[model samples]
Target: MRRIVNITILLYVLFGVSMYIYFFTGSDIGIPVEYKGTSADPTTFMNARELVLSEEYSSVKNFLFFLGTPFEWIVLFLFMVLGVSSKFEQWAKAITSKRFVQFFIYFFYFSISMFLLIFPFRFVSYQLSKAYHISVQSFSSWMKDMTIDFWVNFIMMFVAMHVLLLLMKKSKRRWWIYAWCMTVPLTLFLTFVQPVLLDPLYHEFRPLQNKQLEERILEMAEKADIPANHVYEVNMSEKTTALNAYVTGIGSNSRIVLWDTTLEKLGENEVLFIMAHEMAHYVKKHIYWGIGLGLGVSLVGFFVVYKLVSFIQRRFGKMMRVEGKGSFAVIPLLLLLFSLFSFVISPFTNYVSRYEERQADTYAIEMTKDNESAVKAFQTLAKTGLNEVDPPMLVKIFRHTHPAIVERILFLESYDGKIDR
Candidate 1:
């Protein structure tokens, strides 16, 4: 029995290390390319914008899109099989009898599962882009991106998981109340403070100084019913050519950030259209809705984790290993199991996001009355970003946030007679 458990642990570690090696080694190989554009080109600019707004790229990105699905199934299968297996159940009963063993086992599985599942996607992205001559062929650049993302995401995941676990242990029956209390304040802080405060740790942001463009943008904001005082341009070109703009912060900190590349590449009308879409997000209170949705999801996630953990503890308390005094090595395993459980729930979350995105699009079209500009902007974005012209329907349903560019254009075409609102 001990031998079997030890072998399972070894297999888990081996699989994790193999995946990590595949990612790092693949990313070390670079693709060489000479970019034709010295500054952000209009075509490139438009392509970038379109890529963000399109569901077309999901074909290639499907590896990641469907990655979690299999993992979730595997987890469910493992848990159920183990639960029913007389040998494993006897071992778990023995192990879970010790609190330290139970905790360590859950923690170990959680950490390893998360690391294995998520780490390879970064490598996949790096290799795919290099293959297509989209990304620079530099190990340092790849490492930089990987490291920055790892640290930021690691902190967020760690806090969320630990807090959830603590809450579950504390309240038992009323855990939801405690979880909600902890979640709401943290969500608000992350939304309002992190963008301005913590985000700069990973990327530099500087004020954009195109006086002419800034003035025009401010005027446009005023016309759109968004306060001119809330608009700012930031120099995001210092990073990569991946053009992006976002409306972040709440209340006084709330502002519109136009990436330098976006400002340089887009025409006045296109920029206005983009800004109008962002404004629509604010006007429709999408941020608050997002916060509420996150809380709801977390609540569901807590119940799932709690029930699963309790079941495991009740069934297999004795057979798990004790690594140290009062330490059970199963904590990671539990975390992994919980993550897998959460992955199963991801499709529902994605559905909610897609709905919100559609709502924002409707608001943008209605408010801007410039459906033509929106369509052109999306096309240019798709081209510049080298996004796939069309993605498979399954990919779009599972992974995409925005509607397909072609779909958006067609929708706009149907409204040709309308004036710019």
Candidate 2:
């Protein structure tokens, strides 16, 4: 019976992954490369406002792009229903009945199972990236980074689940509220330490090497009243060809970081525009506001979960071998619920993000007073990143965090601000 169950689980995983790739990833279909506007603004961007990719290229990218959190939720559900988590708990009990030791053992067994189950998706995604020349790193180097990422995520999951499960064991009804409360401080702590501690484990970082450019960026930061001590540069070129920049951490820990690739590939004007966008996030207090909004939504989510989880536990716990929220066996069920909640709330979350992203774009345009620079920077980013210039409304509402590239460029071109320096 046990062997049959194991085989069933294996088949389910194999079949599910294949179907997921086929339906959600995308098929081999031709994609048209057409720009909407006929008139080219030579002052704005060289290519007018358009995104062009080969039919094969689009398929490969879309193929690798697993649809959001559903895949994750499905994998978690399978892991639970197959009694994988329970089996791990049983194995750990043979080693030692100690709750502390069991949690650690359970963490590895469950985490490794989840990781391995998702490994094919990761492997295929990386393979496609390399095939497309977007990822430059060798296979061995990629695996090392993946290992580091796994451990970092392991620690985070352990901390969060440990607190929640402990609370669950103590009080049935109030644990969700307490867990939500705990996340406020925990989330901030992780955010504060991420740039300082965790990020270095995966990539090397240094202060910007070009003193002239660094000084100019600092000047803009001063104008924006952004209190960054040093503009940092990360060695992202070692891994991928993608361009990215962001502000991370908070208060004493806050810093604006640019990818080394940005320096290598972009002109100095474009770099300043990018810096202005990141600085706007800090100057506008988007980071803190984001945290506040997250906590507020979390409070609501936890309340909903509090009502629903017990009902689930009461109805299906014994049959599924997931006794309650406190049981390790319940992890998969909880993940299913969390994934559903996240997916339902995603549109609202993305709406907020898109709004903030537009604000940053506007701020960059106003601060730099160089619409040309902002537009060109985004063009470069879209070219490198293969961003959709004008996504449909559904994509924007459900997934995209930023305004479409064409929309941003058009907004910049039409804005009434001029910088006088």
Candidate with best TM-score: 2
Best by lDDT: 2
**Residue ranges of candidate 2 with Cα displaced over 4 Å:** 1-35, 38-60, 66-68, 392-394, 418-421
TM-score of 2: 0.87
Question: How many clashes show up per model?
Answer: 53, 0
Clashing pairs in 2: none
Residues 1-421 of candidate 1: C-alpha lDDT, one tens digit per residue: 5465466557656655554444333222111123223112223344455544333233345544455345444443344334322333245446677654544345445444555665576678767666554555476866776667766766676566556656656666666467667877888888899668876765656565766656766676676677656456665555445556777888767767777677777787877778777877777787788788888887777677657655665666544331222222333445556567566676777777777766666666776778667767766665655654434555455556676554555566455445342
Q: What tens digits encode model 2's per-residue C-alpha lDDT throughout 146-190?
A: 899899889888878777789889998799889998989988998
Candidate 1 Cα errors over 4 Å, as ranges: 1-58, 68-118, 156-177, 234-239, 316-330, 416-421
Kindly provide the TM-score of model 1 when superposed on the true structure, using C-alpha atoms. 0.70
TM-score of each: 0.70, 0.87
Candidate 1, position 93, lDDT:
48
Error of 1 at 141 (Å): 3.2
